[model samples]
Target: MSARHIILCINVGSSSCKFALYSVSGGAESIVAEGVADRIGSSGGKIRVRDANGRSIAESDRDLARPQVAVDALFDEFERLKLPRLDVVGHRIVHGGAHHVAPEIVTPALIADLKRLIAFAPLHMPGGIEGVEAVAARHPKLPQVACFDTAFHRGMPERAERFPLPRELWDAGVRRYGFHGISYEYIMQALGADVPTRLIIAHLGNGASMAAVENGRPLDTTMGFTPAGGFMMGTRPGDLDPGVILYLLEQKGYDAAQLSRLVNLKSGLLGVSGLSSDVKTLLDARGSNANAAMAVEMFCYQIKKAIGALAAALGGLDMLVFTGGIGEHAAAVRAEACQGLAHLGLAIDPRRNDSNQDTISAADSRCRVRVIPTNENLMVARHAARLVFPAG
Candidate 1:
């Protein structure tokens, strides 16, 4: 057995690839180096790698046409930097379908199973599979683990996970599969025994979702079936009426691809604002447009409604956790979501909220409002280490 082990955690997105290296010590893992490769395909930019302290160690510009070549360059960087052997590679797969309800060692069968879920997460799974395939080709013997973003919600009750549809659709597997499991799992792990019996965690980022977790297990989530199915996202429409899709198909003669593009790209904050999808920019505006303000208002309203629904699912809410980029930093958005939740005894102290404190809840608030940074990389590394170094 190796005395020292290194784990590489990879999260591959449509046009970006984020990598993190971790080392185990004192029965806990710590990140050593992490970076991202953005704009992988066309007009490729720089590859940035930095140490734990944010010290730049290696960086160079390159042009590429695909993720496979980009991932290959990452391996070359490892050699140039004299990085140690990677004991295991943990990948962030977007969809695992019904088969992978937990992390699994990467095998040919598992790969095939994951491939079948590509259509379910068209924009994400392809890049993720490309990264996995690239790594497998370069390092065949290295143990690899596939950690799913949907697996944490595997335990959702039939009622909560099921979509109200015909029996045939249900039988055909047309149901909700919540994502951002890695982040949700990290929050639960952070809570430990302190985790309340009923909890609602809001993961607000470019692609956002809220999960109803009871006793540290996922009971329901905001994003259902697909990433585009959740609350309004930076660029993706969420929870549109079925009639809208029908209108697009029948009236506009739009196909699946065109509809997908509309819902995933030309919608959300950008669509509403006709400005930018970024929340920070909207917040900084001197004068507000009706559409932008309406978009922001609608966004918060949707989140509040989701929280209420999840609270109902959990019977009651005890812990309300906020994670991800927007969740952690968007004080105004958080306040708006908790506005009418005073009935649930959820109140945020204006001063604390503005300071971006972890605990923003008022002293008398019943619910504990905490802002926890999502460490998906560390979570993936831990899961990979458990599989690669499992004790007999």
Candidate 2:
């Protein structure tokens, strides 16, 4: 098939469904169109579609009170535009446990298995499954692929993947299944022949994690059994002290839902700043509250510490990559991360860093630095297409 054939990649979240239309030809994928439907199941929802350059092609503010309804409306927009039928549909599933090491052709058995894994990532898995079902309903015979966020971390050594708990828990699949594999995989492909032997990829966004990638495979990562365990995120507690949980139960009489809400909703930068969960907001009003400034500082500190820890895991470091929302856009965060890494020869050219260039490393720097914008959607599409037509 020609590359002009489009692929629809869906990233269904609790509050939104992000869809991207891509044309994959000549081993490269280009965004043909993209859209996001926000506030699904809520009042005042909107859907905005844009072309490759992010120019809005169409937008609507109708009542999309359910995920299925929103997806139908989106397909209607594509039909109105006289777009070609999708060659494949890629869905991002948050966890795959040990079964799915890479993207797989979505079958009845696979869907059942994915449904079983829903307890692993309760907040993310349901919405993802909803998108998959919606797509399957719309195009019953269309090829579908499931790209796992934990698939890349299957590269982790048995030791790194294991927990300190009993073998019973380990056998029951209670171990680390690092999230954000698609992001790390995209970075690895971007590195191409320049792929580093020992590296750490920081995917900093609302939901963040750091993966210690060696030779383009995950060796160890910060995120644990769930996405809620990694480095501090916009609203997550990250690595929490076990004793704090005991205290919350004993002192505050907190239930599972209450604790989940506290850690996943009211923590991280928002908890520290007593302000917004967004980095841009914190940066804007950093002067207003010392707490806000401190929140950003602490965020950077945790990231730097994770980098150092990953370096230690690899015995040394050759490169460090920053991706995702905060990682690509925040120049100050990048500079601050490389500040004390002189010992490892990680130096950034001030001009390059300030300009938000991809290659921000100094010419003579010992360790390389790159700011690769992640394209999980494209990666998902490739995975799905590969599964559907293995020898294409």
Q: Residue 357: error of model 2 in Å?
A: 1.6
Residue-by-residue lDDT tens digits, candidate 1, 288-340: 57777877887788889999988988888898999999999999999998999
Candidate 2 lDDT for residue 335 = 85
**Best-fitting candidate, measured by lDDT?**
2
lDDT of 2 by residue, 1-392 (tens): 55455789999888798999988775567889998998988998898999889899898897878778778878888999877688888888899988799888888899899899988888888888888888889999988888999999998999999988999999889999999999888888888998879888889899899998776767899999999897888999898888999999999899999998998899999999999899989988888889999999998888888888889998899988899999999888788877898887788999999898988999999888988999899888888767776564
Q: Candidate 2 overall Cα lDDT vs. reference?
A: 0.88
TM-score of each: 0.97, 0.96
Model 2 clash number: 0
Q: What overall lDDT goes with each candidate model?
A: 0.87, 0.88
Q: How close is candidate 1 to the true structure, as a TM-score?
A: 0.97
- Candidate 1 residue runs with Cα over 4 Å from true position: none
